[model samples]
Target: MRILQTDPDDARFAAWCGVWAASQRADRPDELPRPAREHVALGRRLVEPGGSMAGTHRAAVAGDAVVGALRLLLPVRDNTAVAYVDLAVHPDARRRGVGSALLEEAGRIAAAAGRTAMVAEVDEPVPDPPGRAFARHHGWTCDLQESRRDLALPVDEDRLSALETEARAAGEDYEVLTWRDRTPDALAEDRALLGRRMSTDAPSGDVPVEEEHWDVARIREDEAAHLARGRTVLTGGAVRDGRLVAYSELHVPLEEPERAHQGATLVLREHRGHRLGARVKVAVLRELAATLPQVRRISTYNAESNRPMVAVNEALGFRRSGGLSTWSRRI
Candidate 1:
């Protein structure tokens, strides 16, 4: 098998890569299947510098056909020493040395770049047949566990009203804002204010990421496009003091009916301790219920250690859905 450093600019092959991912998704149980257009858009974003682009993606090709591929994404800057391995092996061609070849190439790329490690997220009940053996054979170690939760919507109106009332009593200083055609100027400033919190607060395991490596412009484009595609709703609540203290997103899957996923709900450091976060979250859920009542479930995941956020989610009625394992190994 020969490995090729594929060009991100090759439109025809890029389109093929998008199709390959969607086809692979067909076998995964939890994720909703994606349309070709959405996959293309996602692929474009992942390779774009300000977007989710990591190092390089290589394809394992035999003769004229592309059989397997590997995707490496740079999720954190300080962890520039590391890369997230988003793996894909065409269903028809698994076990033919495709996966092994791809992983070997990945290690070479990481080492050359001066990165110290590489990681991937795998589902649990691990020692179960396929993936467990594959990971072990590759020298990948499973280290962390994450819990997933799902919230049924149309949040009891009484519950929402009561929470809103309690929140207002705590401090009637922040208002939740969405990004419309004309997003408030304050929104941009709020992102800046909350930027530090994002770089430091999220559950990145042992990776130090500085704010500079984060592509703010890419974030804006992706968020805007995601909104346009009707995939996500982003809400930021800014304090009257001009600070964006808390933010959350309710992701509405485009292809699936009545299913939405939640992204990171961040509350700035200084803004903690007050019941503001709990209020902000419930308020967003309530608004989602009122506006997108068709949504059946909303889901989120938290590091098993994030007690504060988990407590808030539990209060908002999100229940455990599943768990994912974050495995890391030094090169």
Candidate 2:
């Protein structure tokens, strides 16, 4: 098999992107199938500095046809010693050496870039999915477990009202604020601080990563990238003493009107236990309901170990659909 660099705008890249969606549909029959346009947007190259890029792509071709794909996410600002991998072999090409060949090339690329480890997320459904087994058989350690939870939208108003009412009493000292797309100039710095904390504060089992470096400039760059990628971001933040203490973000792709994603919800450690997480998420849900009523489902992934946040999501009516195991191996 010949592995070649594929341009995002080219047909091969489109075919390569299809491999991921196709694999998911075949393996996770219970999950909703992603629209092809959404998959293409996901695979679009966002080559800004640091961890902003969707990832670099390599298409594995054999018999003059593409049968596998590889995405290597390199972190420049931090975690310079590792490469994040997203690989998929066409269902028809499985067991034909396509997966192995693509992974071999991935290691070479990571090593050439001076990275010492490769990390990947594999499906780990009940009874041990083939993908997770393959990772273990190839010497990758399952480092973390994240379950995908989905909430069917149009949240019951009475339930949301009660959640908000309870949260208000708990977070009475804080104020909730909402915005769309970009961070307000006054809260830009606050947003950056939370964004940086997200890297370290979130539960990251054995995954090797570091606190992400963030600043107002980087925040603007990220917002710009989102606009360029056709993604609409809705954010809700909690303010205490005129500074943000907690925040939640909702990401909706313009093309996929029916699908939405819950990006991150964080409360400063010192600010925890006040239901700020729930309060901010409730604010976001309200904004989503009012402005983007077309969104029918919101998907989120959380480490199984994060009980507090999981409790909040459960209270908000999210149910588990599937899970992913983070697999890592030293090169």
On lDDT, the candidate that comes out on top is 2
Q: Global lDDT for candidate 1?
A: 0.66
Each candidate's root-mean-square deviation in Å? 3.7, 2.1
Which ranges of candidate 1 are over 4 A from the true structure? Answer: 1-31, 46-55, 61-67, 75-78, 124-133, 180-183, 207-219, 224-230, 255-257
The per-residue C-alpha lDDT of model 1 at residue 253 equals 59
Write model 2 residue lDDT over 1-331, tens digit each, in one string: 7999885677787677677777777887766555555545555534643445435789999877788888888877678888999888878889877888888889998999899999998865564787886787788998898998899999999989999999999878899999999899999998899999999998999897778888998888778766766789999999999999899999988877688989989999989999999999999999999999999999899998899999999999999978878889999
Clash counts per candidate, in order, are: 1, 0
The candidate scoring highest on TM-score is 2
What TM-score, computed on C-alpha atoms, does each candidate reach? Answer: 0.80, 0.93
lDDT of 1 by residue, 154-259 (tens): 6777777777687677766666555422235646556655654676687766433345333355456646667545475645354656666787666675566487
Candidate 1 accuracy as TM-score:
0.80
